[model samples]
Target: MRTPNASRAALTLAALFLATLSLAALPAGVQARSSDRGKPMLINADDADHALDESQPTVLSGNVVITQGTLDIRSARADVTTRNNEPTRVVLTGSPARLKQEMDDGSPFSANASRIVYDLTSDTVTLTGNVTVNQRGNTMNGPRVVYNMKTGRVQASGTGTGSGNGRVSMRIEPKNPTPADESGND
Candidate 1:
């Protein structure tokens, strides 16, 4: 048996732990371009099946390409879900679906996977099956990777040989070293 206050405290601690886990999963200072969300999303494909009913998904097949501001995504097929006449989610599939976007600091961010799901409402991108993500010079490889565009939180995991050994791996580069002063001032 637990008291109400104890339960509240446990909930708070759980929330804090989850937040810390998200922060620790990825390298610091990683975030998508802030203006990208405000820009209109443009999608192009060889063929599109625009559903008349709101409940039906809009399917795009054959060389699907989507772009928003500095963000770009390519896949063999994409299924888009909408709510209230606005896109809520997009699921892309291919031999390897690819995504690229500019980070907040103007650095390039990219990822590749067999399948990628972008949730607009949650501002999250989830990649599965041989997932590989790169930002700046840092790289992460795993079976699955989930990135929160709004919070810049990344969570990756693996139980398959996608990372070469059925494990998740990351290579984070050190920050750039400052140049020596040319004036020779001590």
Candidate 2:
């Protein structure tokens, strides 16, 4: 059972997830509308010494790097699940797995976490263990975070294990006029 607001939120999240994959490109000052959904996915690894089972997850270890369009991900190891020759999910693990992408607003976005799980089917990204996300000058830190690329929504939780002592921290910079905007052209 779900409440009205909860159902609405869920629908929005689902839509956002889908949009993250299907969007092409949008103007600046806006959230990223373009996605790597249809782009070619390339993976590079120092060592790929394991058998790949189509029905099972494929694990890549030793400096794994994945790239598609403007999205780049790096980790010490990754487990990729594929469906019909396409990747449906990826679980990345490292001292701090890193992910970077260009937002629709022309800002750079980055994140680091010990474990990152990206689910293509649900279009959601979950980060756990010392998760940190940065967009332009803004920063967020927490023990766990779930990000919706399409809606730019982020949900974070503290590091506490029900002790209620942990806390999530965030820093958001205010938007201000640049030097050029402050001074008119002569």
Candidate 3:
């Protein structure tokens, strides 16, 4: 389903993002003073609680959200761990969840889809499921995306053999999506 036009746009966006990653003003990786100080972590949901076992780390479930600093990870379930109780990382599980990271600078970045994983220690983020990453005005979308938070590196992909630059389609204007079939065609 790749079109020549969207392919072109994706390539252009990828190039711009690569160039921007070198600039310090972009947000996904910047660390403010508060980030090192360890801002409060917030979790919200319609229902939530934590469970831990001698066999497993603390797990929080049900529309879970965990946020600290400018990094926010959301999903149906999240396992929180502290390396020696110091909160080294959090792992989330859910279909098409999202992770949004805002930098100390004015720049911001976001990932959308299922199978998204973040490495808190390294500040690296991976998005699977038609992943899209946007920085400033540049954007790229594909089946998966890997963003290195500490390094501000981003890569998007559809397949191993697919073209590195692919066209992405969007509009400055928003429009409603087509309604699903009443019979249950999701």
Tens digit of per-residue lDDT, candidate 2, span 21-112 = 22212234455426654565566777653333455666668997766666777789877666655566767799998777676656776778
TM-score: model 2 vs. ground truth: 0.64
Q: Report every candidate's CA lDDT.
A: 0.66, 0.62, 0.50
Best by lDDT: 1
Best by TM-score: 1
What RMSD, rounded to one decimal, does every model reach?
12.5, 10.4, 15.2
State the displacement of the C-alpha of residue 17, model 3, in Å, after optimal TM-score superposition. 18
How would you encode candidate 1's per-residue C-alpha lDDT over 27-104 as one tens digit per residue?
576566778767755666788766555577777789976677887777898776767666667677888987777777
Off by over 4 Å in 1: 1-31, 34-41, 119-124, 147-153, 160-165, 177-186
lDDT (tens digit, per residue) of candidate 3 on 104-171: 57456665555555555776655566555555555566666667766766665666324455444332
Clashes of each: 0, 1, 8
* TM-score of each model, in listed order: 0.65, 0.64, 0.51
The order by descending lDDT is 1, 2, 3
Off by over 4 Å in 3: 1-39, 45-54, 68-72, 81-83, 86-89, 101-108, 120-124, 148-155, 160-186
